[model samples]
Target: EPEVTQTPSHQVTQMGQEVILRCVPISNHLYFYWYRQILGQKVEFLVSFYNNEISEKSEIFDDQFSVERPDGSNFTLKIRSTKLEDSAMYFCASSEGQGSHQPQHFGDGTRLSIL
Candidate 1:
């Protein structure tokens, strides 16, 4: 089975600093996404990328956040001017199709803690 993998299982950053979270999605997957779950909160959708462009995004994914396919094997989320509220478990997910019914494979996630 294919799997999505995220680097730096845990990350600590000071407020106002910039942090980049990285992920490697399943090779065969065509769609990629980023989601975050704050402590004691539900998993919230951040952004979705396809065809080398952002396909969809949630309000939580403000200008401070950006996603990129820097290379063939990597997808990254850069949080500029990080804030304390940004602390969360950021998960990378991938799917073969864009349909809502398609199952998404998720990574273990990078635990981001803003100090």
Candidate 2:
């Protein structure tokens, strides 16, 4: 089966630096999303993209953040300026359809560390 893959299972960065997390979404999926989880917090949705445009985004998705589908299979998240609070487990998820009822498959995660 096709599965999402994320690079650098763990990332360590200094505050005010930049970080670009990479993900390869499952082939044949239409909607892609990015979610994050603080060490002991609930999963939070950052943004969702489809058809080369942003479909929905949360307040957490501020100007410092951006996402792109560089190619047919690669999806990337760029944190233009990182902060200590940005430390968390970043998950890359995808769904088959556009409805909330559709289940999303998530990658293990990329643990971003900012000091």
Candidate 3:
């Protein structure tokens, strides 16, 4: 089955370092999203992208964070300056349609570690 794919299943970064997490969403899905789950917390939305633009982003997705689709096939999340609190499992998800009605396909996730 077609599914989202994320690179470097495990990432380790020093505090104040930058990291780029990559993902290739399901073949034909139109809506793409990024979410992260801290060690003991629920998954939280980071940002959503559609039609080459960011549709929405949460406060946690501040200046230090960014999202992009450079080649029309891969979606990326960049953290310019990572902190201890940024350590988490970052997930990539895609859906054919929008909102709650659409079922999103998620990748296994990239585990980010900050030290």
Locate the minimum summed-lDDT window of 10 residues in model 2. 95-104
- Each prediction's whole-model lDDT (CA): 0.95, 0.94, 0.95
lDDT of 2 at 69: 97
Candidate 3 positional error at 37, Å: 0.3
- TM-score for every candidate vs. truth? 0.97, 0.96, 0.96
Higher-ranked by TM-score: 1 or 3: 1
Expressed as tens digits, the lDDT of each residue in 12-88 for candidate 1 is 99999999999999998889999999989999999999999999999999999999999998999999999999999
- For model 3 the local lDDT of residue 19 reads 99
Ranking by TM-score: 1, 2, 3
lDDT of 3 by residue, 1-115 (tens): 8879999899999999999999999988999999999999999999999999999999999999999999979999999999999999999999996667899889999999999
Task: Count residue pairs with overlapping backbones in model 2.
Answer: 0
What would the TM-score be for candidate 1 when compared with the true structure?
0.97
After superposition, candidate 2 runs with Cα above 4 Å error: none
**lDDT score, candidate 1:** 0.95
Clashing pairs in 2: none
